[model samples]
Target: MKSFIILPALASLATAHYDLVFPEWRGDSFADGASQWIYPCANVTQEKSNRTLWPLDGGAVNIHMHHHWTYYAINIGIGTLEPAFTATLTPELHNTTGNGTLCIPKLSVPAGLAKEGDNATLQVVTFDSFGSALYNCADITFSSKAVDPTDCKTDGVKDVIVGAEAAKTSTDTANTTDAAPTPSQSTGGAAASFGGAGAGVVAAVAVGLALMI
Candidate 1:
């Protein structure tokens, strides 16, 4: 019989990958293309003004990375309703003109930015423009691998019990089935995603199972 325990075991192991997604909008002229993506994050809020002089418009880039090398997906600019407001990563600087670059002080898309511990602030930016300088705000989300990970918790005792029972039921049915058995695996990866709370729930289930044995 395949190792049934393997399913939960797969929970802990880590993987790595990268992705980039951004919303675009119609451009000013025909040549400027259909649209542009301003920030790469889902909901990016930028407030550019004086007082902060790190990069364009005193904007900041906050990266809250964690364990393992994380690949980030960034949204340059979501679609815009305004005609003149073209949101996209531009190479423009402050006090300049001409259809500036979408991303400000555009940083070279890092060749595989890694590590949860890795941190940086994007206060000031500099990118090549036709003539002037502008501000920029880029949004990003990271993961260890390309496949999207679920943000589900281990649930609770009820959920875990339901899952365990469901797992056992599926196994027992396959045993008598005419079709060949594929295999069994652990519930690591996603299980661990339950954050810190998952550990407790899994431990409880294990203890409860031991009693039954």
Candidate 2:
């Protein structure tokens, strides 16, 4: 019985991961693809602007994770410019394996950051205990109006209890037979991505993760 229980714990440790799932993503892409992380906005060529205009005040962004991590952060910047500030969404989150929604609330645009009709990028980064950082980006437009505090607070939030319970339920159905892949299976190099055309931008984070530090 002890050996049987230890097998499940090891399985949980090997399969934890996170993905970005909100703001519709700039490129109409999935977070699991390495190409999505290569640019400030994923699939830049497909759409220069996201039809959805994000609120300046009290805006909520959402994420999904199969595992908990040490730190999670979100940074917003105008166009393809590098982000200067970021909000630490979660500091030292302890649970190692749980699938649910993660929400970052009250996203306030900095003064003089951008005006209405401007293109912007929102980058999400998370650090795991393995010392590997996961990254994702969303391309969005700035909304002219601010959101009501009351509505914004409750509108997009998911119930923590429900999510946690659901994650636990799925564990039994999850495949535990496959062992973690060996390092030899790693892709030898990182993904190469460009920011905006003529901006001479490089997808630094994508490049780093593909190399799997």
Q: Highest TM-score, which number?
A: 2
Q: Compared with the true structure, what per-residue lDDT tens digits does model 1 show for residues 99-149?
A: 212222223323333233222222122212111111223322232332221
User: Best candidate per lDDT, number?
Assistant: 2
Clashing pairs in 2: none
TM-scores for the candidates: 0.18, 0.48
lDDT of each: 0.25, 0.47
Clashes of each: 57, 0
Candidate 2 regions exceeding 4 Å error are 1-14, 27-51, 80-97, 145-213
Stretches > 4 Å off in candidate 1:
1-58, 78-213
What's model 2's lDDT at 11? 84
RMSD of each: 23.2, 16.1
